[model samples]
Target: MTDTQAVQTPDNVAPVLVVDFGAQYAQLIARRVREARIYSEVIPHSATVDEIKAKNPAALILSGGPASVYAEDAPSIDPALMDLGVPVFGICYGYQCMAAALGGEVANTGGREFGRTPLRVTETDSVLLAGQPAEQPVWMSHNDAVQRAPEGFTVTASTEGAPVAAFENLERQMAGVQYHPEVIHTPHGQQVLTHFLYDIAGLEPTWTAANIAETLIDQVREQVGENGLAICGLSGGVDSAVAAALVQRAIGDRLTCVFVDHGLLRAGEREQVQNDFVAATGARLVTVDAAETFLTELKGVSDPETKRKIIGREFIRSFEGAVSEVLGDRAASGQKVDYLVQGTLYPDVVESGGGTGTANIKSHHNVGGLPEDLEFELVEPLRLLFKDEVRAVGRELGLPEEIVGRQPFPGPGLAIRIVGSVDAERLATLRKADLIAREELSSAGLDSTIWQCPVVLLADVRSVGVQGDGRTYGHPIVLRPVSSEDAMTADWTRVPYDVLEKISTRITNEVAEVNRVVLDVTSKPPGTIEWE
Candidate 1:
């Protein structure tokens, strides 16, 4: 899902390429395809016919985007791509595109449908909507709708906004729907996607967690060679931990796991990596105490990107130094560490603009923040995997529940959690607040319900509040509790009032230099889950 295209995938499964037309859920569509046990990836819409054919894709999925089919400069695909003998499935904007490209009619009928709408199936013999009920609700977001089916296609379904909402040509092995079938809001979305992948495209479901583990382990073993050595930096998160575990399984003692206590992690994270992870996997461990070094590099830095890049550079330096200390003369003579293992996930790569035509949201510490002079080749086993898939692999590897089910933690650590300059004092304050939030969420059994609750310290912002009997001006702690499948799109978790009250009350009472506790109710677009 992240940079694993064409030549990179060592696995034998032919990939299902998702043609991204600048839609937000392009990655989601790819994930859904993978969920169907079909290896899938996203390709830019600009990819030429021959460029796409080189991958020898099992099928091609056209992702929905924010564009009208009839626009003068609308995104267009080469007509020859349709002539290829492969199954094609399009959604929303993609449906309109397919219709217009096949000489069907498309126009803004002034009928706009957003959110869950009732879809009426017109044909029961449809391939995509086969055996489905006559009436069902589907998630739709579009304006310009397809008005007619092309020469050999059948109009299967329709909505109030558009008449030709779903169309398919059985002989050509092509199908499309105007509604988003990848989201949970549409009850039968997965079923329809499965139908297309299986009944129409004849794709097999081979992307299970066990299969993923075996494939990734094989890839790591092949890349690291028989005697090559690799070092993985443990970030105490599932991504890094899973990546380390994969490398350890690939080349047992040759993989040295480094725990860099950069003074930016949570209170008990260093201990978790030093004790729990070691006990779980018996990985060759090298602990690097670079807290002071990280603070020095991050001194006077408040910009999120700057902080991320600095931390990334220092992390590589820490690994490079550890290589010399652990390997000694061997490193000097030629047995230098050949790889730097990172727990880089697909979301990290996507947010870092790993996709074509994707804008950089923020530089993830492991992905976009590394310096140009890095000598070790990055072995990101989890780069093509998402956070959820990484967890599955960790569980498959028999790691402990605590390590495998740990919450999502940013690689930049507490530096980005503090919205201002990160000092020892500020880091301490955020750690305390973060710990309390985690404790409360876990105690309430809400850990399984919500994705992550980021406790941010607004170091530059302070307000006046009465502590006991005196006016106390202290920094505010913002609690971001969001629920998401992947870190891509998130919604504010609808946590119970009692749980929020407990977290807020505990942080205000226990943590010093902080009196105000505010909840960030905004979602991903209007605001990111992290404050910085």
Candidate 2:
């Protein structure tokens, strides 16, 4: 799940609010909560207590951060959170914060406890660990430890290194754990989280994608009624495709998909969206060829953000034109198009800050790209789901594997992969290199191991190398093979040396105008998925 899904607040579902303490795992907590079939949201630690209370969350979770309680700028829990009358769960730094807020002591232990640690549950009778074994393995990554519990709190579990690993206050319905339960390294993490949600907080697990589709379809039927016509913006990508499929399922003949074939798309992308999407979903699709228009607008533009904005603007124009044509034709037949459907997922909404009305990371063409004077009401059926869940729902709806399981491609497509200005020559060069990398990776059975292997072309930079006993001056292609739980944050995957060698050798030998191949080892904090 990306940060978008991490903070998505599904309609009519009771939400669990996760207070962000600048922890990397803040989103993980939200993902876990959603995985438990409960909706959740995340807010920055700087958010005021009143702001948090206004969300009316079913429960509260404080995320762990890399901070010591004694530090000057450490994140602290809001006192108002305690009086909100909702169950609260704290992890790591959050655990320390809870202890300190309730008059406990937190000491900085010079010796750090990182990675997997055996946690022994001394009191398994507690609601959080009700049906669990006495001793279990839990993941721990912390430098500070809680020395004592606050008043009315009892130590429920502990490890050899930390004395107060787990503590609970039944009267306040509050609990804290030093170890992180959000990570997969913790064997029983999900079980403990489920216990807290169902056994302690009394929340029901009913947040399935099927239930969401059923509920949204009813709402769509009511809003659109019998005479309403809807136009869906279908990007060949999974999010948009899934959204279109769901909306079509909701309002069959009333829905029309507008797909813009920007020349920046990967090889065979346009055909897939044009032919495969219609064949799979049977939704009426309108294809707009804006390749020349996009290329014309992107001319002479080298800045990454500028290219993104230009592409977004041009895409909207093309889509609007298609919608107008479809609407005009329908109007001649006495039908009207009143709703514009977008496959805007929760990540796009949350990252764009659509949920809390805050400034988003950047303006997305689909989510934040709406015109002020637009007339159509918005219909986003897949807005409540994560990408993986969206794929599952698409499969459940009988979408083909090629359409449902396609890897994520950025909106800018190969334009972002080309280092400098995006032109036909540069895009072609990058496409060839990218295709070679993908083919080789798939041939070597490394496709599933790596989330995405972005093949980047350094158009402006050239290196001299010997090929066929002659010196050749050509640009190098960088292979960024990253492993991620969600696209929000990622780490470089450790591809086998033999596989890497094959990818390197093939890209240099087969793909012309390329001399060298390198790998990106950086993570998301340092580098985004796309290298611009």
Which candidate wins on TM-score? 1
Using lDDT, give the best candidate's number.
1
lDDT of each: 0.87, 0.79
Model 1 lDDT per residue over 422-478, tens place = 999999899999999999888999988889888899999999999889999999999
Q: Give the TM-score of candidate 1.
A: 0.97
TM-score of each: 0.97, 0.88
- Candidate 1 stretches with Cα past 4 Å from truth are 1-7, 328-333
Mind giving the per-residue lDDT tens digits that candidate 2 earns over 115-141? 988888888568787777788889898
TM-score: model 2 vs. ground truth: 0.88
Clash total of candidate 1: 0
Compute the lDDT of residue 139 as modeled in candidate 1.
96
